[model samples]
Structure formats: C-alpha cells, structure tokens
Target: MPQWDIAVPTRPGRLPGTTMAGFSDRANTFVDVEVIPHPGVTVVFDLGDLPLVIDDGNGQERRGPVVAGLAPNRVRGQGQPGSFACLQVRMSPVVAHAVLGAASEVSGAVLDLDDLWGRDALRTQERLRAATSWEDRFTVAEAALARRHDAGRAVDPEVAFSWARMVDSRGQLRIDRLAAEVGWSRKRLWSRFRSQIGVTPKRAAQLIRFDHAAHLLAAGHTPAAVAADSGYADQSHLHRDVTTFTGSTPAQVARAPFLAVDDVAWPARR
Candidate 1:
C-alpha cells in the first residue's frame, strides 16, 4: 500500500458532489486490487499503456477502461498491469445517474465505458492521456462529466433527499422516518429510491454504515467500539457486514490497501 501512492486532484468546479482521484503504483510487479462497494458510483479510467482487467464478481472478466456502478454486496477485483496509473471519479449516486446517463444499465454490474459512452469513451481517454499534468487531466475529465450531467435528466428530488439523509446520519436514519419526512408512502419511497439510486434505501444505509465502520476499524478502533459507534446492533453484526460487503474481517479490512489510502485521498470524510 505504501508504494501505491495516491494523488488527490485539486477541486475542479465543473461537477458538483463529485471527487476526482488518481493512483500510481510504484511497484513494477503485478498485484491484486479489490474494491468493495462504496456509497457512490465509480468511473475508472486508465492512463497507462497496459490493459486493466476487472472482475465484477459476475463470473466473467471485463477489462478497462471501464465504468463500474456497484450496489451493496457487489465486490470487484482488478489485476494490476505491473506498474499502473489511473484516474477514478466517484459521484454520489444521485449525481451519478445524471452524469453517467445509464444508472439503470450500470446498476449492480460492471460494464465497459464504451458500451455506455460509445466513441466518446476512447476520445476522452485520448484527451486524458494527452494532458501534461494530473491537474490538466482532472480538468478534462470533470468537464466531460459536467457536460453529460447537464444533458441528462436527474433523479427525483425525493431520492436525493433520502440519500442525503443516509449520508448525514451515517446510515443511522430509519427508512420509515425518511419516507415520512419526504411525504412519500413507504412502498412508493422504496420503489422510487431503488429505481433511481440502483440500490434500495435499506441497502444504501448498510453500505454507508459499513463505510463508517471500516474507516473506524482502519483507524485502530476495536470491533465492539466500532459497532456501537457505527449504529450496528453489536460486534457480531459488524463482523457480518464486513464479511458480507468486503469478504474480510475487521482486522483484515483495517490493513487493506484500498481503505488505507482513503484518508489521504478523501480527507473531507471528517
């Protein structure tokens, strides 16, 4: 993990509720990379000359450059091409549907960007690779995202409100409460939310809660303490979630390379 240095791009004003990040692997040997389901949708672009292989737990292997939208419990693996460099854009699901223009298509699966963006995917990659600096690349990428987001239709406001509640409460908010607050019946809310956000409201809450607990564990908190602080029922509940979402125990996730670099790459979490 130490050798996999992450570079955080300066905030570009093009896209709202989006974070652009870059990772460079100094190690010139092949390594395994696994990404658990986070609260947002991920769009990964390869800047290197080698191909990036991705397995979306779909019993088939898909290669990058790819756009991956994962629901809760959808695990993905990446085979690094010895030395690799890539840029990843994480958009809150509410924004992702609009930005990617394929929320329903991308939900619960990983697909090549070409399928969604067509020729634009390769064209964007060329622009990204031609950029002189990471900053320039970030600008180019964000501009593209902004264009799509502006052109596409957005999710329902109720869906956005429910999602905000999930994040603001760290997934501790109840679905019934969210539905009441948004003036939607429980069934209606559930239907719209799952359709718009890809994952259901309850599942989204679990993912957000798991994200919080994972960070706490990585910060050296005991499972018991993390469970209590993260609003889980107990340590066993936390363990089940960690295993279900990540296929790893608390101790293992604590040392995970992907979660390890998050603080530096996404420092706004605090």
Candidate 2:
C-alpha cells in the first residue's frame, strides 16, 4: 500500500462513540483509494485546496464534505490533482443517530454534508482548515459532534442496549435472544432498531461480523480460519459475505488498502 500522512487523535474524544483520524495526501500526485464497507456512520470534512471526490462505482460522484451511512458498498476515493487534507470521523450507529440527526438519511447512502448541516458544513471546513495542526482539527470536529449530539433526539435505550450486545458478541448472538435480554419483544426491537440505526438488526450484525473477518484476513489469516473464528457457517459462507459486502474475494480483500490502514489510522481498535 502507498503511504499517506495519517494523524490520530491526541487523546480520546469527549464523546464515547466517536473516533477520529486525520489524513493528508501531500504528494500532489494522482491517487485512487477503495473504500470498504464498515459497521458505522462515516463523516469526512474536506480542508483541501480542491475538494475530495468520492465515486460510488456507478458513474455517480460527490465532492467536499460528505456522510456515508452504514455499509456503503463499492465506494472509493478518487483524489484530484492536488494535495488534500481531511478529518475523518467514525461514529457508532447509536451515537450517529443523535449526532447526524436522522440517521436513516445516511443509511446505505452517500450525501453531501450541506444536505445535512447546510451552512454549518462550510463553516466547519473553514474552522478545520484554519487549525494549526491535526490535533487542533480533531478538537474542532469533536466539539461540533458534541454540540449536535447534545441537541439531537436519542434512540431508545432498548435499541442502544441491543447494539451494545451485538458489538460485545462480535455479532454472534441471536437477535431474538438479544430482544429478550433487552426487555422488548422481537417485533418492537426490530422496528425500533431499523428506524434508528438505519439497517435492520440482522444486517447490522452481519456488517459487524464481516468487519471482524475482514480485519482477520488483513492480518494474514486464511479464509478457512477467518470463517471459523468469525462465526460463519463455513469458508464458503465467509467467501459469499466478503464478495457481497466488498465486491471482492476473500483473498483480494485481504490485501485491500481500505483494511490495510486501519491500524495506523485507528490504533485504539488494535
């Protein structure tokens, strides 16, 4: 993988469910990067001379600050011919629901930040661009998220508890059992979780499981071993999930740049 300047938060954010990374491609060379699916909401603030371009692999593209909802499939960054700097934020869907307002708007979609925050998006870019360093930029971004989260409507506690359980078990627990534990009927839990988290509970579980398996693959584990460890029925099941989520085989995904930089950019996960 090609090296880019990556910056992490100097300290944990005030918010519990958010992680920050700063990235800059200062080479002024042509660049293209594939973006794999992940189980959270992604917000990117552009502070470059030219805007960052995101291609959805279907002839559609968006530039400038953008938000991608859970499990956005087959997306990539096509860097313009210039240096680019941006602060990228990953939010747990529980927090995303409050921070981004209507989380369903971003679920499985890529949208302009302006659509969500309007004038505030531009103001945020200016603030981040004026910051002296990556650490400062992370501070600005976190403050903005904290403000929105404080004012926005929150998801039900039952739904939040369900998501927490899924993450705790690496998505191996049964959803029906989760509902029982959360003190909600399976029907109510499913409805509330889908409306707030953007994806159905089962889909969220699959995404979390797929993320774990992908990282294991990137760590040099074989497909058979990754499948067994990640709770798939078998190697073939893992292969299908990998192909479905990333449009790539397990072998190819193991070498993906998207997964390759997770450790450098988000060390806390390691």
Candidate 3:
C-alpha cells in the first residue's frame, strides 16, 4: 500500500481554507476508520469500485452518493481500510457552498449517505477506475458533479478568505467585527453568508469552535486544557461538543491508535 500524505491545496476563488487529500497506495492495508475531526464539510471521490460502507452510529449500513455538507460530530464507518483508494475534499463551510449550490441549513449530526450518493455514485466510481492521476481523478469527479441537478454555485476568492479567517478564529470573534473587517453590515454579512455558505453565523461559529478544539485534541493535548484554551466554558463544554460531534470523549479519541495521522493533532492553546 502507498503511504498517505495529507495535502492542503491553495484556496480557490473566495474559498479561504485548504483542501486536504489523502490517497493510499495499492499494497497498503485497507483503511477502516475515518474520524472527521473538522467542523466544515466534505466532498469525496472514490477512485475504485471498492465498496464504501458508512455507519454513522445508525444501525443500517449505507453505500452511495458523494456526501455534500455534513455538520460537525458526524462519524462515518468505512468497511476495512484497505479495500479502496479514495480522495477526500475538505473545506470550510464557506467553501462548501461553492460546490453544494445553496448555503445549507440542515442540522442533523449524521446525514444519510443514500440521500447524497444515489445510483449515479456507483457509476462514478466505475469511471474513476480508468483515471491515471489525481488531476484526472478530480476531473472525472468534477464532470460527474457538473451533471448533478444541484451542484450549487462556485464561491469567489473574497468570500472564501473571510470564511477562513472566521473558522481559524474558532468563534472567538463577533459577527459585527467580521462584517466591519469585510466592509459589510451585520445584516448584509449574514444575508450574503447564508446565501453563499449555508447555515447561520452562529451555527458556523459552533462548527469552527469544534474544529479548533479537535485540532488541539488530536495533537495530544489534555481535554481540560483544550477546553480552557479553546474558549469553551470549561472541560464539560468541550466534552459535550466532542460527544455531540465526534461521538467520543477526549480520552477515547486520544487513546485511539489509528487516529495518529499527521493532520490529526491536538492544537496547543496560544
């Protein structure tokens, strides 16, 4: 199997954050566990017909469409890690709107995989088998997305940068401050943000906070300090967010050996 390297691509358009791509070589063990420690959303590309099973704490197993925008704390189960080679496109909520069309508002922690993939998802996977390079794979995926009924509008660079700053701040900053910095009113900011990014400012803030905390926890930080430093009211607040978004405690996550990937780390409080 090929070693996986997480690559953060330059922000595109108004998209401010980076895109992380993880690809495994043919001989490696299959990847079974995928713990999403970020609050934004994902657009996945399956490069092979290998079955991709997702169990988000739900009893039934699902396999289908590429997921669009899933809120924080969503857990997905992939059957045996080595079974497939995949590409995951990670983006902040603002960047998500560029591909998902409208700013999304659904609040469920786990989205149904069937709702996103449909039958066409299988066809896409089949076509990906012929792809030779990452760029080719992305091209195939983009072409498939273009055929979707609701692929959403592409985001501009300015909006993406604003969203990045907000997410990177972890909800510590106020919307008015953000608006002022961007030269827009609170109302105008909210309106444009909702239309383009989906979710309200408050919800987006929550996701950002969760993501910031996750970054810290993954890096080997203690939960107590992570909470205090990440601006949570206390350790309990951090625990609640972790439980709500990741379905696990800080201790549980910290002890998990498979999650030791490089991008997965606990961020030290600044």
Candidate 4:
C-alpha cells in the first residue's frame, strides 16, 4: 500500500462551505482504492501522467477529471503503476450546486468534468498541472470554483438552511421539523431540496448520518457504541445503513483508507 502525500491549505481560503486537499503518490505504486459514500460532492483535477481511473462495478471505467456526486456508492479508484498527483475539492451540497454549475443536480452518479464544464474544465486542469507547488494548485482550483459559484445559480435559502441543520445534528434532525424551521411545507421542501441539492432530505440525512458513523468507526469506535451514538435504531440498523452506503461491514469501514486520510487532509474538521 502506498501512503498519500496530502497537503491542505495552510490558511483557510475565502470559499465558504468548501475544503481543498492535494494528494500525490510519488512512489511507483498501483492503488485500487474503495471510495465510500460521502454527504457532499467531490471534484478531482487529474494532474498526473495518466488520467484517474474510476470503476463503479458496472464493467465501465471512467478516466480524467470527474465529479463524484453526493452518496455515490460502490465506486473505486484504480491507479496505474506510476507517480500521480491531483487536487481534490469537497463541497457541501449547498455550495456544490453553485460551484458545479450545470451539474447541480448530480447525485448518485459520477460525471466527467468536461461534460459539464466543457473547455473550461480542460483549461482548469491545465492550470493545475502547470502549478509549481501545492499552494499554487490550491489557489488556481479555488479561483476556478469561485468563478463558477459566482456565475452559477445558488440553491434556495430554505434548502441550504435545512442542509445546515442536518449537518449540525449529524443527520439526526427530523425532516418534519426541518421543514417547519425552514417555513416551507413538507412537499415544497422535498421538491426543492431534491432538485437543488441532488438528493431528498431524508436520503441526505441518511447519508450524513452514515458519514458520521463511518468516521466514528474509523476513529476506533465500536459499532454498537457508534450506532447508539449516531441515532441508528440499533446495531442492525447501523449495519444495514453501512452496507447500503459502502457495501462493507462495520469492521471493514473502520479500516477504510479513504477515511483514514481524512484527519490529515481535513484536520480542523476532524
């Protein structure tokens, strides 16, 4: 197994609701990484000798710059034997709608960046590949995100508020109460949230809850304890959720390489 050289911003950038990390594998390594489901959206800028390979178990593999939408499941990254470097950005569904522009309704799928950004995506990749340092790459990436965010449409305030509440509650918040708090009827909230955020509120909450429980498991917490703490009905409920989102058991999730790198990549949040 090859460990990633992860670099995060020394100081927080101006972009709100977004985080950036740069990952490079300098050794001649072939890595097959199982990617777990996450609550937010992910964008990867491939800056390596070869394009990033993503397999979703559908007998098809996608390469190059791609966006992993919220709750993308059963996906894996298979890197060829050689050095590889990339800049990765994770955005809240709220911010992702704006930053991702045409791909705003992305959920449960991985789409090529060029399909959405067209020539702009290729230009941004070139800029990232040309950067002399990780810091420069981060700068270029953030600037590109900022531009898209500014020009793209934003989600409704109610949708953003509901998302924040779910995140704050670690996905334990009730959907009914969220709608009330947002001053929208349940039907309206559901329709808007699904359209703008890419997933329904209930599903989003489940994903967020799964994310929290996954991290706790990665932190060495026992499944039973994590289940009780994360609002799962019981260990069985937790088991089902974990299996649904990650296609892995609690034990397997606890040792996931993707989660293991989070503390180093997003230390403050961890």
Candidate 5:
C-alpha cells in the first residue's frame, strides 16, 4: 500500500484534540487514499467533484459525498486513484453552523458534498488540485468560508469555541460555570448553542460522554472501569448511554475488533 500524505493544520490558539489526518490505500489500487474523519461537525472541501465509490457491503455502490452531517454512523468510500485530496475543518457542531450557513439541526449520515458546493463544486475541485501544498488548500478553504461570512452567513465564533470547550470536557464541566467563564448568561448561551450547534448543551455533553465511554470500552476496558474512567455515574449509566448511542453493550463492542478501530464517534471514533 502506498502511503498518502496526511496533514493537520496548526492554527494559532485552537482548542486541543480537534484535528487529525490519516491515509489508507487499497492493496490492489494505485491511488493514494486518505481519510480525514472529524468531530460531530466539520467542513469537507471539494469532495463533491471527486470520482469516488462507497461500498456498504449491501451490493450497492454510491458515488462521491457519501456522507456528511450526523445521520449515518459511518461513511466509507473511495476516491479516484490519484485525484482525491481534501482539507477537513473539524469543529464542534456550533462551528459547523457558521460554515454551513443554516440552523437546520443537521444530523444523520448524508453523503452529498457536491450539493453543499452547488455550482462552485468544479471550480473548488480544480482549485484543490492546483494547490501544491496543504497550506495552499487551507488558504482556499479559508477564503471560501470568509466569502460566506461576508455574505451575512456566519455563526458567532465565541459561541462555537465555547461549545468546543464544553464538548471537549465530556460533560465534566457545568453549563453555569461555562456561561460564567464566557461572560454570557445561561439562557443566552443555551440559545446560541442550540441554534448554531443543533443540539442543546446538555445533549451535546451527553454525546461527548457517550463517545468517551464507547472508546474506552472498544479499547478493551471493563464496563465498571470504563464508567469510572469516563466519569459516568455507574456501570448501569454507562451501559444505558452506550446502548442509546450505539445500540450495543460494552461487551458487544469489545467483541467486535473492527468497531474498535473504525472512526465513528463524537470527537471522532478513531
């Protein structure tokens, strides 16, 4: 397998544990394959214009933009042998609202990158291809986002950054404290968070907790130990959240080796 280059941008003063890059290649193919799985919210660039295939093992194949948002638990697809490269901006769900330009409570796995770009898909793809470095690609994506913001379609950065901090803490932090830290009233904080991030602050916290618990379980930790480590109230509480988020018990997840490594969690299930 050829090793494709994966680059994570280093933006000044960004939150921790928010970005990553990995490259994978099929044994029989020549194209360098890369996967950039982001958090609950992210921006994928120029994926719509790529020639790719998604296989779900159901005897069906889907093309580019195989999945976006929070609908599907996983998005698996392939890009052209050498034509697919992307820079993903993984943000908390709140940051997503700023870039997506809508407050539509986006969720479920929907693969339609082309639809997101609309008429500019081809141009964006070309620009991505023309770039010789990841930095160049980042510049293009940033400019595109800036244009959208200038058009009166932007989410409040402070709110988005706050939400990122909240989720990063995995519900360990309290909303009241969070609001006070950010100098906003509880009501105002919740309002902006829900509008931009799609889920209430409480729900987002739960999801982050669920994600951490799931990762520990998948990594072979005992349920009781995982519960303690993940800040769950008890083993039963951990089990409940695991079932609610993934429809399975800790033991079940532990038994599935593939699930352990697959990228599919809130902060990204890698």
Candidate 6:
C-alpha cells in the first residue's frame, strides 16, 4: 500500500507518540477491517456527532468517543464510519494509565468516554467541536490530557521499570529475569504488572514482539525472516503469534486495509 492511501491522510510531518492530529471521517473510507491489538492505548475524541463501534467478541460493541485499554491480541472496532472526526491519541501504557484513569481489569475492553470521565467526556467533545480551527481543537485536547495526567495516580515504579525494559529489548527479554532485576518475586511482579498495566508481563512481551513482526511484514519482509528477527523460537511459532494477535496470517495482515495507512497516521519510534 502507498503511504497516504486513506481518503484523508495524516498531515505532513509527525507528532510525538503522545500526540495525534484530527481528521474528518473522510480521512479513511476502508471497509470491513478489524482493528488488531497493539501495545498502546488509543483514546479517540469524536468531534462529529456520528457513532463509532468497537467489537471484541464478548457481545459488547461500543459506540462513540471511547477510551480503550486493549489487552494483547484483542480486536476492537470493526469499521469506523466516515462521519466521525476527532483526534486519536496513541500513547504508551504509562501515559495511558494516568490520562484515562484506567484499571488493568478493563484491558482488552472498550468503554465509552462518558463511562470513564463522566460529564468531562461530553464537555470535552463539546469544547473540541466548538473550536474554530484545528490548532484550537488540538490545544483543547492537549490541555485536557495534561489535566488528567497531573491529576491521576501513576503506576508502580517497579512495574514501570519492567515495562520500559521490555520495550527497550523489543520484548526479547525474559520475564523471570525482569522480575529478578526489579527485586520482585515472579508472583508479585505478575500480580502488580497485571493489575496496573492490564496484561501480564509475558503477554505484554508477546504483543510487543508481534507488533515488531507485523511492521516488518508490512515493510515487505518474508514471514520467516520477520519471525527470526522478532525473536520467535521458529517460523511456526511466529505464525501462531501473528495469527493469535491478528486473527490473520502474516500475508493477510500485510495486506490489511487498516495497516496500509499506519506509517502515516501512527508512525512508530522504532
């Protein structure tokens, strides 16, 4: 897929991972695409009055401006309609926990923004819609995120440290070693990490690794090579992970309409 194949491509240049630009529902016109799980949390602020849907196979398909804390390998939001417009922020789990005031138990789940922030969600949407220009809208979104970040409690230091290490290693590190380095027993680390970050350390690592592999596939690499480079024990092991996380084979994910626009809409630091 070409870099800007969507109906409305991301603006020129890029924003930090914590930041994302708004686009009209005209931005993408793709259809019947399932959004696969990624490592970060996605907080979408819907400016348009149209509805949004999230399907995770639990009989719950949410609609409209939602704050989702996705767990490893879960799918959400089948296809967004063209009438929605808003800023969609993709953030590290640390920043996500603070701004969304999310609990780990809600991971792999999608909740309407109203459910999380109550009237603030409605108020913020109204404020964004009232803005006269994109700059003003972005400013309002940033300010709201800053307010929440400052007000919400942070995750445990050890949990943060382990998560950071896992990211740094591209999810190649051993969970036991990570626990040992943080001076916590395996059980303690598992409990705290799951409670705070939504997914267990092992699962989190697998998700991170799959993300790496998926991008490689999108970049035109063969699955065997991607699997090896992504630290899979073998090619079939790699296939299982890709299938588990995406419900698609490597080839299908590579051709996914959703991923065809990611490098532009959500460029990763790696």
Over 1-270, each residue of candidate 6 has an lDDT whose tens digit, in order, gives: 111222222343232337565655445553244676778887777665555566656677766667767553355543444555556767778777887875674577777878878898888888978998777776777778778878988899999899889888999999899999999999999999988888889999998898888888988899889988999988899889888887789998887765666776665443
Compose the digit string of candidate 4's lDDT tens values, residues 1-270. 767899998889898888999988867588778888878788988877866798855667888788989887688888877777778888988888888863344788888888888899989998988899999999999999999999889888898889999999999999899999989999999999998998889999999899899999999999999999999999999999999998889999999988999878877551
Q: Locate the minimum summed-lDDT window of 10 residues in model 5.
A: 30-39
Q: Locate the minimum summed-lDDT window of 10 residues in model 6.
A: 1-10
> Deviation in angstroms for 86 in model 2?
1.6
* Candidate 5 positional error at 20, Å: 6.1
lDDT of each: 0.81, 0.87, 0.59, 0.86, 0.56, 0.73
Off by over 4 Å in 2: none
Candidate 2 lDDT over 64-115, as tens digits, reads: 8889899886888877778777789999999999988787788988888889
Candidate 3, residue 122: how far the Cα is off, in Å: 6.5
Write the number of the candidate with greater TM-score, choosing between 2 and 3: 2
Give the higher-TM-score candidate: 3 or 5.
3
- Regions of candidate 1 where Cα sits further than 4 Å from its true position: 72-82
Clashing pairs in 1: none
Q: With candidate 3 superimposed using the best TM-score fit, by how many Å does residue 210's alpha carbon deviate from the native?
A: 1.9
Evaluated at residue 89, the lDDT of candidate 6 is 69
- Across 133-169, the per-residue lDDT of candidate 3 in tens digits comes to 6666656665655455245556555556567677668
How much is 85 displaced in model 5, in angstroms?
5.7
Return the lDDT, model 4, position 60: 70
Please, what are the lDDT tens digits per residue for candidate 5 over residues 1-270? 334445544453133333433233323244422222223654455442346565433345655332355323434455665545445555445544554555453544444546655655556656866877766666665666555444535567667667667666866788888888888998998988777766667777777776667666767789999899888889999888766655667787565433433443223431
lDDT string, candidate 1, 1-270, tens digits: 326767777664557778888877787556467786677888888876666677777677776667777563345555455657788888888888987775767777788888877888888989998998888888889888888898888999999989998899999999999999999999999999888888788888998999899999988999999999999998899999999888888889988777878878777651
The C-alpha local distance difference test score for the whole of candidate 4 amounts to 0.86
